[model samples]
Target: MYRTARKVAVMGAAGAIGSNVVQDLLSCGVASRIAMYDPYEPGLKGAAEEILHCAYPDADVSWTTDAAEALTDASYVISSGGAPRKEGMTREDLLLGNCEIARQLGRDIRAHAPNAEFVIIVFNPADITGLVTLVHSGLSPSCVTTLAALDSTRLRAALAQHFDLLPDAVTGCATFGGHGEKMAVFKDGIEVAGVPLAEILAGRAVNGRTMSPDEWNAIKDRVRNGGAAIIKLRGRSSFQSPAHQSVAMLKARIECSAYPWPCGAYFADGPYAHVMMAAPVTFSTLGMTAAVPDGDDEDVAALQDSYRHLCSLRDEVIRAGLLPPVADWTSLNPNL
Candidate 1:
């Protein structure tokens, strides 16, 4: 039966972060109908069962091994379906594996939840996975978003430490390339309390180390590698903040505020790069509307860099049979 009840679906809800996201969504009272989808699972007892057993035994919930069935009637879908970083392998290898997973989810969305809002959380290859989703889901590019903000959040935390201020008080921008070592974290136009970050960091000490652009670069590297660090310690991608972010993203979508947190979005040759960094956008009851301002040259450059990198990853994914090739994204990259 096609139900009228509003719903939210989390792919890989049986995994670490997806479980937390599902938990937070219920705890935060953000979704009345929550669905967990993991088609390869044995049965209803999935990754989330343990959490549900102790906490949300009576909450409205459903677990399915069918992605299409899980997504049906959902207003929003957030997926954390991918392998967490572990033993030695290049990022392209990660994207290849995750792209296949993302492609499967994208195909399910096309068949089951054509109009659903898209918010994917399968890290690292976020920008690339977003591209795969956009291509296969047959949804508007604007409807898709990825977990790029996780990186931005880490950048903000590092800056907060450098400036001797609360993380919330420090705002930073990251230029695009890849989600790895090559990424550019821009301090050129970053602000703290409405002032340049350079000024704010002039007085602080980070573990007996003085702050400098070089130090900031190191910090950004740490931010990019933060997830890998955790995986090393936990043998999985780990959890917590990602789950928190999933809820935050879901609320923004549910409220239609779209208020523009940095994320992954698809690009089709415009003033922006090929694959867009999720900008601060406003979401209304209708859909995604408006791009949040980066408000400067440096921020724009960072995003452009990411776009180029995304295109590279896009080619990599396409070659791996996870996505169709772009004839020539050059026609689509007006900014490049």
Candidate 2:
């Protein structure tokens, strides 16, 4: 458990994911105070009242439209503020609008809560939005991350189902690169009770069956498109899973867990150098320490390709003036 009391600020506290995140935080007793921010007054008020009524009755809960006020003195600032992806829209389609939202919030957070750890949950291009937040907030890259753990959760669940094992038994499953389709899963690094998952998958009778290459590809595709599949069925992107995953991430960061976990948009340098992309990161009181890739050649190449794709998208956003100037990003500290 965290030794010190924590004040958390949720930037889009009225939105679908934001509301769920607030509820989870209250349920988990993770925050001593929570400041909710949203542009919609009615929704914000309703969410605050409902959350207060249900849990953490004695906790200090407040709502605001002013970003700086909400972020003031916060230990952790989580931004789920952005446009949701509709049925026909890709996550990339939300880039410009969401990036703008992140930029404004980033500036406000920097001004008000410069020491707060930041987590970006804005959609479409989470990696780009995270980078924008890091640069605009003028915070060290280590102080910021995005929710790539959601993807890892989905992948782990998928693999667990395939192997007829509980999700908890499928250890070391990680998703790297962008939070989108280009992201790669490190199957080689995955294990089942300390045994390599690849070895088990290759065995003819392991778990009563073996997963062929084609079957593995199908699982990968499902994990990659899991968000879109949910959107197609429900007419909106996911909220519950994202909220749960975000809360878990906050817990890990607060407790300074040293185990490597998949972080959606942590800073990367070696191998895929100088980018904020999804990768395995060990969190401690000092902040993020990215794990170097030691997977097979194909997996490493895929990870690199994913990094390049994010770099291209980052360049595009910068050129469109949706993100901070390139000079600002290049001048910042490295992902230490």
Candidate 3:
């Protein structure tokens, strides 16, 4: 039984990221049969038959209206379906709609694909949908993951350009916190081949842009607002970055190799899992098995700040009745 021949399902496969992900998986020989699941039975942009001819012609491809049917015998699920952030829209704007979509899909997965791993690739308010899916699916948080690595990777790109360093040289740096209005990227302890990030900042200048605390803060804020900036400029949310980040996440979940990533994850210490929105986590086959939040002093402080901001958002979501009651590791589960 070749693994690439195994079944994989993609909800909203015709949409932006989903379509490309299915293709990427096929290109990598990850799944044998690909099922494209979309809620809209009619008016779909791409037909499964046609999509296969275009993207994965040699493999078996199926399209269906039923999400459960797609999940059956599936080895992986890359759920890229959700309302994208549009111009003039806020995170809270698409919450209710995406919440319902995620909740329903969670229930379906729980019933049809219990124990199957999932990757949620929706935009801002992913944690909200994550909470809904957690409750509905009752899946261990380990089996369900969200796409926060994109922000972290973005931060890395910004720093790489700022310091005139190669993108691969950014071995350090992680973006943490909610992928909302309050995301945090930690660069304090950043080192390139053992050189401190601050040292690099002091010695290098890029396009006349020097790295200073003020400049760093400004750049970070711009990175946080990068999505909004794109939306405003493009009039609609762009798909390239989302699709790019999503594929990387799929690699993390399936390949489970040691990839250092700055992404959102449920940090399990003793017996409870709290969201670690900002931290360098060594991702492997188990979907974020450990969280190494320990970093340089400034990095650690930034991490603390990131955790605080996440807690604040969690509190607000709970208070607003958007999320169920959440407890830290001690109050929740203690068997990790």
Using all chains and alpha carbons, the TM-scores for the candidates as numbered come to: 0.82, 0.91, 0.82
lDDT of each: 0.67, 0.76, 0.65
Write the residue-wise lDDT of candidate 2 on 172-222 in tens digits. 887888877788777887876556777766764446656777887898899
- Arranged by TM-score with the best first, the candidates are 2, 3, 1
State the lDDT of candidate 3 residue by residue for 198-255, as single tens digits. 7756766444445777777877887888777877998766566776566666666566
TM-score, model 2 to reference:
0.91
In candidate 1, residue 245 scores what lDDT?
79
Model 3 Cα shift for residue 152 (angstroms):
1.8
Global CA lDDT of candidate 1, please?
Answer: 0.67
Ranking of models by lDDT: 2, 1, 3
Give the local distance difference test score of model 2: 0.76
Question: Once superposed on the true structure, which residue ranges of model 3 sit more than 4 Å away at CA?
Answer: 1-3, 42-50, 55-57, 85-90, 192-194, 202-210, 268-273, 276-278, 283-287, 319-322, 327-336
Best-performing candidate as measured by lDDT: 2
